[model samples]
Target: MFVGHGLGAFALVAFLATVAGCSRERAIQLGIVAGLFAFVPDVDIVYAPIGLLARSVQTVSPDVFWGTANTVHRGATHSIVIGAILAAAVAAWNIPARVSRIAAVGGFLSIIAIGAVVDGLVNAGVLVVYVATGLAIGEWARRKRSSTGWLFGAALIGLVSHPFGDLFTGGPADFLYPFDIVLVTSRIALHPDPTVHLLAVFLLELGTIWLAIVAYTRLQRISIRRLLRPRAVAGSGYAAAVFVIPTPTIHTAPLFVFSILALAIVGVGIPAHPFARHRRSETLVTGLAAVTVGAIAYAAAYGTLG
Candidate 1:
């Protein structure tokens, strides 16, 4: 559910941002901090979307919500400039003069209770961590300049890191919109070319998943080499199985073994771990990688919505 056409690869972006944020000292904590706000830019999805009834209604496409972003999903909101603006707002606003750990804990639980929104159910703990980090940072950035700078720094890291996730699927985000113009695009086409799109998505997910696996393995104190062997067996087996399933296709789906084998072979190179050596800061490097595989497989097997 947290996965999308790089649209909601917030986990991957959060993973990288956390690594650069606080080192291993606050890896898990800051990772959760960044993860919570990483997808806020997409909150613009509610512009014309049904409020609480969205899930029940199941409107196939959220037309206006995305259209507000200049007729695209990654419009004005996706801009690094907009991200900075948001960061400024957070910095300038008098959020809470002082927050106690007790208050933060209460707020964290409240946020989880309110997790009826998209992407909320899966990652509500992010909200909890975000507040916890904010409290910690607020104490550290006590000086006016330091406070503003740290606020700006963390927000910028969370906001700007996301559009690169969009690079895997849609047209590239316009990093510098009104001030200067630069539109990003992926060499791997998103849709029209279904096979190529799936291929690109598989690679993108593979990279992110590998990072998470390495980080998680280290965090759990599990040996990376031992971890990969089982995961490799599973992942490689899944890749191989993809071809054998009687999945639908435009052609004779039953006789599509060769095509499936080729697809699986492409995947065989995808490793259980992408790194030859996991870094010393392994705890900070990851979160939520395997979830995307299910979403990707469903889209590939089911084909386009139309």
Candidate 2:
């Protein structure tokens, strides 16, 4: 759920960057909505006891809140069908005349997906019920009104990625929903390499700061766009290695260090290269810089070989 939320937020930023023009106020608004929406699905714990109590009264059995909460994955709320239906209903009632239909669709889908993720998979049990409830409320009150395809796409990506992120961290989101098979991690973990973990953490922090700077500059209309292609290059390198490396391990300090350096070098070189002819140079540069940090972190966890 944590990883999914972060990705969703990142997706929101990317989508906003393209559509909303990436203003500070808009970013803040998106952040707030994303945070609330991300956790909206897990609100089902409130109903577990109710169901249990009802059963107990009807069948002369005892009810346990914890037990009720610990079970129940995807019954109704988590399904894409239900999500769409609920989203449509909400839109019918709440959408403003001035807002774009696309933005409203995106927002509704995003929240509904969040509910599904939280209820059905991200956190196991009766959480789905609560998520459905939240979805109902959120749908009723929803009004931000982006109503665009880009927004919905971003939100959808975030919703889908949430459980995948949790799989890596060994979270129960995968098991939260009994039938769905989504495994992911938050990408933050105890490094397979101790030294690399520490180093990677530091580099990630720096990268975050750098990204903030770039975003701020963009808001200020500064032309010094960040580079991102280098990150793509690093990703390519990593993909290539996956096939070549016989044994898989996260303790790749050398790879992390080298990737970082490669990203940095590439990032610095981008400005002078012909590829930098575009107006969004700063965006690319920032992306590359961030990739460099990712490489560093990977190296810390799984030291590079050769």
Give the candidate number with the greatest TM-score. 1
Clashes of 1: 1
lDDT of 2 by residue, 91-164 (tens): 44354454544654554455446545655443333433443543454443355554434334333333343434
- lDDT per prediction? 0.45, 0.45
Clashing pairs in 1: 172-184
lDDT of 1 by residue, 1-306 (tens): 123322223344335545666444344443443454465555544433333244445444434334333332455456676555555445544245445334434543444443324234323343333334444443443343333444555556666777767665456776764345666544335656554455556556556655555554454567755332222222222343444555443222323323432332222234565444653322222212222343355445444432
Candidate 2 structure lDDT: 0.45
Model 1, CA-based lDDT: 0.45
Instruction: Tell me the spans in candidate 1 whose CA falls farther than 4 Å from its real position.
Output: 1-25, 51-72, 92-151, 179-182, 185-194, 216-222, 225-306
lDDT of 1 at 292: 33
lDDT of 2 at 152: 40
TM-scores for candidates 1 onward, in order: 0.48, 0.39
